[model samples]
Target chain A: MKASARLVVGLDPHGNSVVRVLRSQSPLTLVPARRVGPVALVHLVSSVTSPLGGDSLELTVEVGPGASLDLRGVAATLMLPGPTGLPSSSVLRFSVEGSVRYVPEPTVVTSRAHHTAVVEAELDGHAELLLREVLVLGRVGESAGTLSTSVRATRCGKPLLHQQLVVGSPSIDSSAAGLAGKRVVGTSLMLDAVPRASDGGEWWNVVPLAAGGTLATALGDDVVTVTRVLDAI
Target chain B: MLTALILADSRFPGGGHVHSGGLEEAAARGLVTDEPSLKSFLHGRLLTTGLLAAGFAAAAARGEDLELLDAELDARTPSPAQREASRAQGRGMLRAARRAWPSERLAALSRDPHQPLVIGVLVGDPYEAALTCAYLAVSGPASAAVRLLGLDPFGVNAIVAALPVEDVASRAVKELPALGSPALDLLAEAHVRREGVRLFGS
Candidate 1:
């Protein structure tokens, strides 16, 4: 009983929200039970019924400017071994609208669970975007499972941020120089917000922001500088 | 031997200790704050921006024309902040390499330097050369993060363990996708105008 789910979110002529879901080879899948609203949340679950071995759950969302959207999964996906006994994989595609804020929590990849995702966004001139994507080595205390994840953030047909991560060893500990030496790692990048430079001949300096834990460094004469933030520390 | 080490060291006095590859501005806006967020940021940068830049540097090391490589890098970088950062670091790296290993190739390239141009003249192996430079690019920011985050020594190792080096050699290329983040350039411009700042030139 394996299944594949496809959910599409779009903006209407008036800029209202519209959501659609196509499950398997069935007819047009529409959520009459749940109509689209200002803030839309859509979840499509694919089960262990496919010939490909493991199940897949994909989430797609479209957030308009001045609106919000959160698309979550039904449960933490477990990639069971295929008929050949190898781990299974899934693909997640996310397309964001202009002026919308999209934040998807850390996706937990159990031992041997391989997932690949492509996130593309086209933001308007005045839009603001704050997003965080995390792939854990394994289940927290237990430390079992492997996760491979890829992310791409784009604007106006160009790419902003793209990354691929694979974690085969959950329990094994290595140096921070490798991944800042943390079990949990996150990245926060902002565009169009150039930091102000200091006087003197030097072009860059690290300064503490309003928050005690946060640090801001303005480098060079460009309009943007992304600060590295480690959530675990 | 010492030439290789100097080019790879994070503390090479090349003024690379500044700039966070868009991390500083991202953090200021609350895009990234803690360990989890920082890791995510690094991962994305390495795969997209880091991957693309390494590829070009590798080509340069392999004897690609210095002018051609510099032009390639210039065209690939879309944002002003990133452009400035690349040139600033390139100039600094060229200056340092000239002093550390003063050879005909290094001296000639240093006259008008760019990141890939200097790297092509100094690095021995195309593959390893790119990896070493890429490592410095990632390591410099990560080290800066240590100072910015006030991270514990033990925790620092944890971060290092997270970077994947196995496939970096093959991934280094001159024409990877462009990782264009306009906000990063915006921040760099603003930083330059501000007075009494502490970081190096972008």
Candidate 2:
């Protein structure tokens, strides 16, 4: 069970990026991966160096005041199998300070990989944030790996959104319960704002958004809006 | 079995009803209406927003330190209004737990207060707590869907049946994100200000 992980730090808007890579013969630890700045990007990469097994990794993101950070990925993440043929896992902790927003793209898990990822965020007054996550089961014909996810959002030390998901033996077409029997899964949430228009029907409305590539839905005011695409994969 | 049934019940007094789980806003915006549309909307939410919160609850159930859980939830939840809403529901549930469970752990957690914290104290098994949290979160909106859209009760149940609860619970334990969307946070904050809103909380 040999593994390697790299933490890359970047501050967008400033157009500066610094990345740190760490490798472990066993599991990867998050203590070394730290980001500092009003706006910074902490990127991480973990790989099972030894083919005979798999390993687990943990990462944390700490955000300071009035900072705007957008964490994007170079590619979809691939989770390898362990020596026992189970998927490896990762945990993410986001520590937020005054008025900073952290947005990261969704995560994709390759086939036959069994992994779980948890994300927790703590916020303060006058602070803001945005989060987006996506998970893919398998590659082509091979068994799409299983992925489990959980997310928590808080303000002034309280809980906002706590969510979890587990997808096992994912297939291209699943039933309503199984990705609604769809292939790709995505969701977006906007916290406390009133909707500009309620004419659509309930407080929430869905817009086609760009003919086909994007599908957007407006929920509540704007504080809590969700946009998702199963076909987006 | 009893724990499963009690926790799974919509009327468990968990204060879950107060939250539309973003459904109120989604429906108000007309993203969801009637049964099928509500099902689709909820399915999307369960995978995304709902998944995130459920994960926190599951982690809390796993007995991660309370202060650590508190810090994590703060970072994940970006909206001020949403934060109030979660704490409101958590506080409400804690009050209810005192009357229902009344265990020392529940009592201690209630003193400080948070939904996941209270749940962690009450539930002995991490998996069971995850299931309970997911059940409460998902079903709250399902019930709201019926009233908001006047959907058929049977169809609502059908949709509920289609939702992957176990999957949601397990996933909640794994793969949840820690990013906040400003666009949505702003909306939720505004939603909380509305005085005549029909929902329980913001």
Candidate 3:
């Protein structure tokens, strides 16, 4: 897979901004040729550069004024131990001035696999945003590997949100510090323009941000139901 | 250490007894019918929301920006009911801690400082603050389960004692994530809207 991704937006005085993307050198690359929706889908069919485990990624995505982008993964990222016997990692840095919607597929942690994803986003006050993530601890009839995910976002030099989570190995003794021995966890954070409140039902809970946004967290035994609850709100 | 012990006391007169930490509604939902279930429920809370509070408390003890800490915690806590419960407890606890510890830093804060921040200020150490926060997370619920469910006090005490406090405290000081149990978060909100005999201030 391609090891790195760079997206830089050049703002035009006439208001139309131009975007340029830097491709990865590995098999893990974003398919830029397929242009349709606001999603940036990643392709991980072959990892020749990545000898043992999944390839590591250093990805930076920037959206300039009035230009929006959507980033998504092609499918659930399958975690497998690499040469160093370590899990894959993705470090994402986002600069947003316009609207950006990221609807990625769930990451399914397989046995002995490990993955960590971290996102640090800087947003303008007027920028609209939608961010979603889903994690399935293990695939069908298998034990999940280890996973840690963190997102720290700021808007207009003000603190917006700082959250990190670790979904440990299947051998962990369930605690409030972990996922409580559940198999699935999913979250959606929306900014600037949060949708209207829905009637409370399902396992999803929405908390309106004092900083002007909404955070919805849903938990279930499976992904399909959890995604439904998340999308409904 | 002595002062820290005093702060850790369950009967600190900070109005903690009034908050069951969602045990009231959890009991209503039949989620904590026995000792094992209560153990699981408490574990879910500690790893998710409890650890977040512990990290904040630890961070507060170092005397970082109290206002920023408050804002950071606000983002992590997505349940309005939990937020209100925290603010109310913070206000009450600050009042009590001010009288006991008497610091200018405590005075500078809004009458309501988040519970962990207050713990950090008085305790003055990250590990102590985090452990205190973790302990506070379960102590109230353990006591409440005794009164609400009429369960075996011995079993409840065992559950609380069995918690790997050091492990949890260490992990708490490592990070404060905006993560939570969906069921617990939703239950807290539901507990707020219900009319009649709601036991928890949360």
Candidate 4:
């Protein structure tokens, strides 16, 4: 299965943010709020069981100057394998001249599932973006399959953050130098003008990126613990 | 080839021994204690961080722009401590390379280039540079484990010998890798903040 979704948000003359374009395909539903405000809220709902093997999904979001958008997910996504045994992939591209906050639910990589997720965000000088991701290895008492997720954010054509994380290799997954045997991994990336001091604990830390922005990473045995760390950041 | 070997050597005076590549933090937390655990740690390091560094080194050896690679590497390494450690080691290596293998290309590098870039510029061969980087990634940590945990040197040597450094190097030469080690990044940050008698820099 192949799906593509697009969303465009812009600021109106009345100083209100409005959705100019909303295109949704199967398994990629977009719901917008009816109220008019400074920020436009959109909920992303999966209309069908998706991301099965051999599935390819793409989502493109564009935010015009002086506009703000908040995109949220309604439920968790389960990555399952299809009968063909092919791999699944998803690409999210964001072109922002204003601000965008994408908060999606956790994604669980079930057994025999192989998925590759990529997120590319291109921001202008005054643009800002906040992205959060939490990945669970598998269901309770189960082992993960395989997942390769990468995020690349560029500001004014300069790279801000580029990281690719691969999970489900038993040796690396359980090794201290890898995931440290943690079942859950979470990361929160904030690319704004706010300056935050570096802080962390034994398993979590919020640190400043090299170019600009702040990244908070947490590894825990459960989703709640990891989510709490990301929230606190 | 000699340049790669000399840089990989512990006695090269490149100041590579001070950074444990997060092994110190992992050991401090008791995550790695025995031979079996050390093997796992080295293997994991070889696959993730090791592969990433090797890829950058290979790109540099292939004559990629030093400044661009530096910025891209910075984007890949989100932890400040890890970045500082790499630059510090790079500075040390540059100092030595200026006296030994001085060249216009070596001089073109920034004052404090990433360690892998330095290795790549000196080696000038993608595969060899990648191999040198992949080996150094786990070798330092393996030695640090022996010093910090009182593990047997022979056992640690065996573990290091068994790592997949060549395989990682071969793969790294194929393309630039952005593999991020979450546990290693967290450990690097925590190591910097730990308030105690720390032996390694990172």
TM-score of each: 0.52, 0.51, 0.89, 0.99
lDDT of 4 by residue, B1-202 (tens): 9999999999999999999999998898889889999999999999998999999999999999999999999999999998999999999999999999999999999998999999999999999999999999999999999899999999889878878889999999998999999999999999998997999998
Regarding TM-score, does 1 or 3 come out ahead? 3
lDDT scores for all predictions?
Answer: 0.49, 0.54, 0.73, 0.95
A-chain TM-score of every model: 0.56, 0.61, 0.82, 0.99
Superposed by TM-score, candidate 3 places the C-alpha of residue A218 at a distance from the truth, in angstroms, of: 1.7
Per-residue lDDT over A1-233 for candidate 2, one digit per residue giving the tens place of the 0 to 100 score: 43434343333455433333333233343233255554444333333231222455555555455454455443445565665885566666666553333334344456666777777767666555555555444554455567677666666655656545566633212322234333444554333222322112222222211101112223221111323331121
On the 0 to 100 scale, the lDDT of residue A118 in model 1 is 47
Best candidate (score: TM-score): 4
lDDT of 2 by residue, B99-178 (tens): 77776556555344556556655666666776676666667778887877788989898888888878877776764445
Ranking by DockQ: 4, 3, 1, 2
Q: List model 3 lDDT by residue over B1-202, tens digit each.
A: 6666777798688888898888887787676777887887777677667777888888888778999889888877767778788888787788888778898888767676778888888888888888988888888888889999999999999989987766878987776556655566677887776678877776
Mind giving the per-residue lDDT tens digits that candidate 3 earns over A1-233?
33776766544555544456645555455554354333333343333433225657777878877776666556666666776675678788888988777877787877777777799889997876788889888788888777778887789867676676777543232532245456788888888774556335435677776677788787778999889988887
Q: How high a TM-score does candidate 1 get?
A: 0.52
DockQ value for model 1: 0.09
Ranking by lDDT: 4, 3, 2, 1
Q: How far out, in Å, is residue B154 in model 3? A: 1.5
lDDT of 4: 0.95
Question: Which stretches in model 4 have alpha-carbon errors above 4 Å?
Answer: none
